[model samples]
Target: MSRRTASRALIAVALSVSLAACGSDDGADSPDSSPSAAATEVTTDLSEKPEVPASDDPAPDELVIDDVVVGDGAEAVTGSTADVKYVGAFYESGEEFDSSWSGGADETIPVPLGAGRVIPGFEQGIEGMKVGGRRMITIPSDLGYGPEGSPPVIPGDATLVFVMDLVEVTP
Candidate 1:
């Protein structure tokens, strides 16, 4: 499939998974409180337009998840849909590939958490977030586009970084 087609397919899968998961709110109330402490320890800035990190290259096996702004609202569970604004960039070149912020305020996307619709690292990175939270996720190539990559925009074996603002969670 073409890159754009694959992306659309992924989004469709995510939406379907979100709808199915939302039908049964089994674990919505049992929010894990451990991440709250970690959120307090993080001091990263979460600008609407975030600056790219200056690192040359991160380890290919690493999946770094840092909370930029911790929210006091509901915790993001595994089978939930999160309304978010995000910017994705290549870790090596610091070039942005996609962004919800670029399309203005109404462009926030609903991402299915813990589903296999998105990259593996992205799914894991968003796990413990709360509504109104901001997070910075640095994903290795293995967990991102992998060996084949997205092409044109994303190079093969490229690591990716995302600055995400979780606006709300629908369980």
Candidate 2:
């Protein structure tokens, strides 16, 4: 199977295990237990910078992309340039490392997809997203800065999390 397909399979298995662990044996009435529900519950407001919460579950070995809000605008593809506002943090600790919104909510940066400008996980995760959409991207270390890491802000072999808001897509 292709890498993407394999990665997706791994994600599904990991999420299934995680959900099973969160379930109660007595089957008591519980809150919405889906991964999307938990992720969406953190922040769904489009106007504000997304808030990425700390995860109790172990980091996945593959990429996980969860859309918090679906947009109704132009789509982003390999050749498209995406103007996005984002907040980046460590997956394990939810400690912020970088953000396009650091300057201001209106401050966004353009990312050239498939251009090798950004990390592999980030570029791949943002693909197929539409303008005005918000997504949570969980990236394994291999797809991020790797074993050496970016340093200062990112640690060695860190699993990164990014809450991204796609503002516009330039074809």
Candidate 3:
């Protein structure tokens, strides 16, 4: 299979696995909590993968969303399908686990919002993003892979960090 096709396949399997995993919800809607990574600066261009720096701070207990670049294009909502380029890493180690950029610079993966097609943290994190925007999301384990995790790539009860660039949002 081509790299883009392979990447899409991986996303499908990941979404399914995340849906089947069980964990308590820490309520991603809370706005009071701030993670250290939320203050990080986004140094990469919209066309390239972001370089996530290692953080020594303790893992956050709630979902944290920070905008690196705000876009004036379409807003992502529950029914919207967003095409984005993203990099996923372990929050503590900053070790990259996956990246759509790995498929190729021209590649973007489509994520169906509010359709239970992705982890809660990811769904919630991308909810309000607009096309051309960039965001850094810090996902607590409860909202990510949970206790079972994805294995190999992601450890059990692991916190995750994602840097995403919204390319488009379509209904």
Ranked by lDDT, top first:
2, 3, 1
lDDT of each: 0.73, 0.84, 0.83
lDDT tens readout by residue for model 1, 26-54: 36432333333323433444444665453
Summing lDDT over every window of 10 consecutive residues in candidate 1, give the lowest-scoring window: 29-38
Could you give candidate 2's per-residue lDDT for residues 10-128 as a string of tens digits?
99999999998887663332112234643765587888777789888988998888878777899888999999999998887788889998799899889999899999999888987
Deviation from native of the Cα of residue 101 in model 1, angstroms: 0.7
TM-score per model over all chains: 0.69, 0.78, 0.77
How well does candidate 1 match the true structure in TM-score terms? 0.69
What lDDT is obtained when candidate 3 is compared to the true structure? Answer: 0.83
Query: 78-126, model 3: which lDDT tens digit per residue?
Result: 9889999999989888889999989998789899998988899988899
- Give the worst 10-residue stretch by lDDT in candidate 2: 26-35
* Models, CA RMSD each: 18.1, 13.3, 19.1
Query: Between candidates 1 and 2, which one is better according to TM-score?
Result: 2
